[model samples]
Target chain A: MNKNFNFCIVDDDDIYQFAIKKTIESLNLTQKIIAFSDGEEALNFMIENLNNDEELPDVILLDINMPIMDGFQFMEEYIQIKPKLGKKITIYMVSSSVDQTDIDRANRISDVSDYIIKPIKPGKIKSIIEKLSMQEN
Target chain B: MKVNTNSEITAILATNNDGIVYQFNTDAETLLGYSSKEIIGLEKAPFFLIEEEFNNFRKDIANRYKENLDSDPYKLLAKYNGYDSREWTIIKKDGSRFVGHSTLTPLKNEHGENTGFLRIIKNITNQKETENELLRKNQVLNAAEKISMMGHWQLDTIADSVKWSSNLFNIFEVDTNQALRFETYFNFVHPEDKAIVSASFDKSIKDKVFYDLLHRIKSTSGKTKTVQLLGEVLTDNAGNVIEIIGTCQDVTQQRMAEIKFKGLLESAPDAMVIVNDSGKIQLVNKQAEKLFGYRSQELINKPVELLIPDKYKHTSHRENFFSMPKTRKMGEEGDDLYGLNKNGIEIPIQISLSPLKTEEGLLVSAAIRDITIQKIAEKKIIEAKNSLEILANKLTIQNTQLADFAQITSHNLRAPVSNLNSLLDFYNIAETEDEKVILFEKFEIVINHLTETLNTLIKALKTKNETVKNIETIMFDDVLIKTKEILSGQILKTGAKITTDFSQSPHIEYNKFYLESIFLNLLSNAIKYKSEERAPEIFIQSVIEEGVQKLMFKDNGLGINLKRHGHKIFGLNKVFHRHPDAKGVGLFMTKTQIESLGGNITVESEVNIGSSFNINFNK
Candidate 1:
């Protein structure tokens, strides 16, 4: 796995965040994992580090249910500032909702790479990492 | 008297003074239809007449000459009279009598003394018969003229005189005794028609041909009548016009009837086509001309099939209709009839047919009405109904989906199962007691969340299933008072000011528990989401909208960002505010309660300004 890659975890649930971070650490996928309690916190960090390549994540796991701002709201704001970022950011919608409406809505957004129902498996995380590494190659 | 022998007299006869047979000329024999050998000197004048007429004539002679009266009146008249003239009925050989005028004269000798008389008679029967025939013919002609409202006239061009029959004077309403001239007839012609009539008459005289014209005449009675003048010029052998004889017929009433019929035909609302028995178009109204896009003259004398579409041209029903015609509506049910316009465009039409009885024969009149608009309107109505059904089906599907979503939430098994799987994976790979313990703690938190979600889903499902059976007439003021009481602690802590107006619609028929819960949830939500920049000011009002009772809850609070969260505002576990007490189940349950009773809830909000929730209660 590429250790130079940065990953973002945006969720209100701390347990889901811990699990995702621990899984990334266990797989040795990256040491630069950044965590946000909600989409709003993640969006604030991205906007502040628009040109900071080292601080911005290459990949983001976004949760639909949050306190301040949800995944869909973050995507709306992210689209407006995405052109100013120095690197491409891959976003995956992660939620416990099995509702087709939510899934369809997430798929319809061009910025969302995919939708992963919680809780994501280690194999799924490993495939995501492998796919990113292949793209870089 | 000596009888003068002359051929000028058609017939003659002479008798002596003794009243015996004397002389009968050949001319008299021929006039009397007798042979000269049978009557000349063989019979006396009395022998040629019937005894009844002869005796009456003799008595009349005796009375006329009383001084010479004797036993024989003829002999006495013959002796005394110098001359006398009388009409005698002479019997013919064939037993037919003839009327003859005879003269009797006294024959004088050279010594100037009275002698035997000579009777000279001539037959004037033919002349008298002709006179009586002419009189009869004149009377018949007068009667004919009066009955037909026609009069005859003779213009003697050579004499420059005009003679009008008695009926002509009557037609002009003029005295018959007055002498009428050509100028008198010309003056009766209407001023507008005077020049034309005069020119026609002059043309006839110059060309020596027949003249036939229809013109308006203003009679002496101040009545205008349409008259037809038909005449022929009488020409001599040398080709010189001698006279002009004509008859004038009053055609005013006939013309008026024709005009009235035309007006009725044109005034009909539908296109009227009058066809003869041979299927030929005889007459068409203005509407028919306009509908078929053809001129009146173009359709007349043409086959009626020209207006029918080609598809129906060969239908035997058309021929059957003519064979046994009657008043009936055309086109059977589910059979569409169309008309072909002059431009060959097919147009939908409805037709009604009726038979017209006329002098020539029975004619069929078809009334055609265009139904293009009706067809289009029917199509539009069907299309609209189909679209409305489709929309209704979509709504039903969405409702089913909502139910399925509620079931899924109540199960709340997906997240817990996935979390347990992840935790088990972590425990299996932990290799350390601390790591396994950390994973176990996380499992507890996941279980708690699952249980909380399931409980909230159950409450929502209960609100949805409680269908409106507990409906009661609840007062808005009472509900507001109770809600205020329940939220008194928060209101005091936040210094929330609440105002209400329920005068317009103070009460509504709704479930009491649901209504109270709605009131409490909306009131607390307003205070809980209040903006810190100002004190909370909440306004509650009840009003009737579109015959439905509605409660409006408005507050000065940190309003929701509808653009981002509008679609999921009423969803279970959907939260927008960061308040510690925000559980996100209050509005969802409120919506469930409203929708379950066939009511609805809508919101209008601005960030950091205010939010208004409108709830319409079921009637």
Candidate 2:
């Protein structure tokens, strides 16, 4: 129910992207839900919208395994341009892998807020949105 | 005059003043080896006396008469008032001679006038001969003493005089003419041995007993000599010591030779054990004492077998060694010889034996060396090699398992499950029956694919687990032939030309099923991804690299961009090309099978030129 929040989904799976976007729309969590097939596209959007607070997403769901510029790689590049950004961003690493190595690597990055395993449930998304709203207050 | 008739006594005779034969004696005849009856009147003093003695006597008589004023005119009147005596050599009529002593007295008338001279003579030839013989014996004794480096001495305690033999003076390097006192001989004694020698001499004199002492002395020439003094006190009937006689011998050379022998024994590096022909230990070096942990006195004169190990104790090797009497190296022919120590510890050893010929008999000298450190080093090398092999084996197993887990997570478990989740969400939100039916149909397709991936993963996992137990010697040529048969349809469709050469390394010990699967996967992948611009050409060959068996699969197909996808080239569901049939499972399964058997799979590729997959089989 935080309709004012902006959401971003960076994943190469079209079906997962469609389901996550629909869930966010049904919950009335945000007016804008930006989607990227991979981490490189998501990073380019963030870099292009560095000065635009309204265009920047408040939350990004970053998938770990991708063809080009994976979730960890985006986090490395994002840190370099972070000081130029006009908005504060919260990132969640999303992956279907139950690998402890992937979870530990995502947690070691200070930029990544948490890790979520797929398929992400609707209730989990709602709680994440609620947690971000509380942070706003 | 009458002669003394005792034959052993002096013989006497007399002559008238007129120098005519007048007397003869039995003792005189016997001494002169002549008959007195033939020479009494026919011979006179002139006949029996030597010519020189008679002339000297006449001259002496003339001079004496001239000194006397009142005398008769006779020649015999010279001794009228005097008596004379002289020693004379007289010759008998037989030409034999005797040494004589004669005395002349005056023969006078009633007017006291000189009438005739009376002569007395004695033969003393035997006494002179006995004295000369005694002198010759003394010279011989002196020569023997000088040659033997020995000397004799006498201490006359009553007279307080010390007499040294001629050789004693030579031994002390002093003049033989010089008088020797007890203190003079003591001056030559070494400073350290002086007190002991003096004490021994005093003890001998008091105890009236024999004394033997070994002491050192410094000669007058500044050279030191070892002297052995042996003395016995001479006592009178009252048990009082009167004299002490002793012999001293210079033993410097003998002592020095003993010291040099001892030096050589101590300086040997190895433990030296010197045993006599009877197997008794005659001598041992310092190293031997330390090695056996026994003192020199403890081992000397003891049986040499005490130092031998129990197993070799009963052997007659010691007797055999003496019989042969030759130098030999022990343990050279790989015999495991050991030496026993004082604490009963058996130590590995190498020994060498040599025969020492001495005055006592032949002795065997054995030099023993410890080899514990060498044996330990050899054992450690073997252990380290075995440990290294074990570590390599464990690392290989862990690597294969990790790759398998990655493959399961990325492709087999995630792909279909994620699709099912997406499809279920679509079906739940569909507003029409047609849309729901379409979603269900997609669900069926996703589930079927999930089953297929799961099945493939199970097969790969089974191959890994059973790789060792199912291993057999497989030929690369046979495997290649089978793979070609399986992919013949694809090979013909793509116009792929396949060639093979397994001559270099034809066979390998590996799981047969795994080998066949690997070949099939690689061949089909090559044909499926063949370059469209040219006919696909594939070369399969076996080679040996760095002592490792290798199978090389090369194809002119669309290759991977190693720079971008090198790390995950063999990863499950990791595709580098956009081809419809590029499932990214063939390489993953091939890598799993190779690694599970302790082998490795590596690839080199360009974007489109070619790709070469090499599998190195572990021995």
Candidate 3:
């Protein structure tokens, strides 16, 4: 319970980003929270903080539909740079699609922790973080 | 010497055993035109005879008596015996000759000693001339029969005998010396034709009618000949058939020619009608009968026009055929030909005519083919092609609609609804009034985005459903100018340089609105995604590729990675570059507008070198 988690939200929907940030802040276990409008912004952030564990996110909530680089495209770029990173990041694909193709594609990526359909409940975020913390322990 | 007989009709003379004339009668003097005053003792029978004939007789007598006979009339005449009479060439004092019957006799004394020979000659020249004429006639008849390949025969029914002429024996390949009988003639008949021959003969005899038949006969040399036999029954005064006289002709060559012609006619796949020079149908094959629905006998001697439909009868090319006959298709002037069958139904037909030279005269053979099924099949093929075109068009439209529906449901509609749900969740959990107000504002933005997406989807669906009717000749340059005007703000901001060359294919037939929209979308995308290293340069040109008019929008801008995103480049809400205005709906909408009007949009690009969007207009 004393452990703090840094969370990242990569999505084009401003309202979803704001809601999820608020939800995570209410948990009291978040030490830092960052938001990117699309996958490219989040990927750039990850490359800039490649060795800085404190700045790097512990969990990434990635949206599938976006104006620019989508979540799947970001995952592709992320996988290529993942070996140089100082920290292991848990990524979850978040979409409102509910389309089997999207779900299947996200699941096929071994780096992706899970696919979560919107709107992601606050308890779901807690469980994801708790699961990650447990694995770390 | 003395002669034994003396008469006015006969001349008597006596010759010593040495052939010297001793006594001469008045009749002999009259016949020879020499008076009895010419001493008989000085004359001899050999003196009046031809030397060659006398010598020949002397040799014949010498051989018979086994003695050397001299040129004496006594030895030549008397050596044969008591009364020998034969034909002789007698010469008179004037050297005129007559064929005479001569008699020679040997006079013997009481001691049976041969004294001399007495001879008598008869005037039989008239009778000999008649006999010679008969012999000459018989030779001429034989020659005529051989030349014509015809032989005559007489069968005596009561006598059970057959008399065949020499030529008849030649025809049968039998020896001329062989005696002919009824059975001999029957044996020459071919085995296959035996029953027919027998029946014909029996019928002719019972009915007392003339018999005529054509049958095959195998000759003695194993050669087969087709013979035409014509027989006439001869009746006696008592009304009984006395004989059957017939003539047999070897007609094998003629028959073979006829059979070959018939075989060719029957083997033809098309109906054949052989017409004489007079335009009459001389013959018809089985196919002709079947096609015209008439018996062959019914068509023979009928005018060829009978089979033609009444509408085409006046256009008969009979005269043209007779004038310059050759092998050619009939009525090749692009007019369809029809034949009227026996049932009065007209059938489409193609005809070819060929000249047929026969012994009787010139003939034309017409070959006819029915094309009803072919015509129907041709019509069906055209109909099928039209239906296939329609089906392909429907499939294309349906595919576009399906893709639009998927895009709307999966991304555009889903994202905003989910954002609204998230905002509602935050609003429900807000602890303060300020937080609730913030959530409500976020809700408003999400709703507006959802509304905008729905409206754009409705417009795209309408474009897909509406049949494009506003087709006009649109200049590529005009569309580009209008698009530049609409995107002038972005063009000015990015310093995009737009150039065009519409000389190759200057204009296209397409919906003006769709053309404008396509131009607007492509030009804005070029300026919006301009490469930071250089000013955006877009070259819009109209060119003809493979006979299709293509409008190319090539840009030197921040191009996409086609290898990675080529599949979904025009997909709804699919954006590759991180740009603020990249909604990903412009290209999708442009593609939809183009494809709905039977055109298509394709993009070729590299990572950063450039991108080219080619629009193929409606053909």
The DockQ scores of all candidates, in the order shown, are 0.21, 0.17, 0.37
Ten contiguous residues minimizing lDDT sum, candidate 3 chain B: B1-10
Candidate topping DockQ: 3
lDDT of 2 at B579: 64
How much does candidate 3 score in TM-score?
A: 0.53
Please state the interface RMSD for every predicted structure, separated by commas. Answer: 3.2, 2.8, 2.1
Q: TM-score of model 1 relative to the true fold?
A: 0.52
lDDT tens digits, residue span B382-411, model 2:
799899889887876677677657857664
What level of docking quality does candidate 3 show? Answer: acceptable
Tens digit of lDDT per residue, candidate 1, span B1-619? 1122322455655555555445666776666666767665653445666788667766677777764333476556546754667777877778887677777676667876654666677766665677779988988999998889889999998998998888888888889888878899999999999999989988888888967999999999899989889998998999999998989888888878877988888999999999887889999999999999999999999999999988889646667887888889865465788999999999988899999999999899999998888879878998999999989976885676476575356324565667677788788889989988888899988889888878877877776665546878988888888888898999999999999999998888877898999999999999999999998999999988788888899999999999878877887667787667776778888987887787789999999999999987754
What are the per-candidate TM-scores when only chain A is compared? Answer: 0.97, 0.96, 0.97
Clashing pairs in 3: none
- Stretches off by above 4 angstroms in model 2 are A1-6, A12-15, A31-58, A67-69, A73-89, A127-137, B1-374, B377-385, B388-392, B399-403, B406-435, B467-499, B506-512, B530-535, B556-558, B561-564
TM-scores, one per candidate: 0.52, 0.51, 0.53
Against the true structure, whose lDDT is highest?
3
- Report the C-alpha displacement of residue B28, candidate 2, in angstroms: 57
Predicted structure with the largest TM-score when compared to the true one: 3
Expressed as tens digits, the lDDT of each residue in B1-619 for candidate 3 is: 1212322357888877666788888788866777766847674446666778767766766766666666444544444553556777888998988877787788767877677878788767766777888878878888888888889999999999899988999999999889888989899999999999999999999998867999999999999999999989999998899999999999888899889989999999999999998889999999999999999999999998899988898634788778898998964455688999999999989999999887899998899998888768867998998999899888866875686577569777877787777777777778899988878888888888788778878888788779746988888778877787888888888888888899998888888988888888888888888899999999988988888888889998888987667877888777888777777889989988987777888999976788999988755
DockQ category of candidate 1:
incorrect
* Candidate 1's DockQ: 0.21
- Poorly placed runs, candidate 1 (over 4 Å): A98-101, B1-413
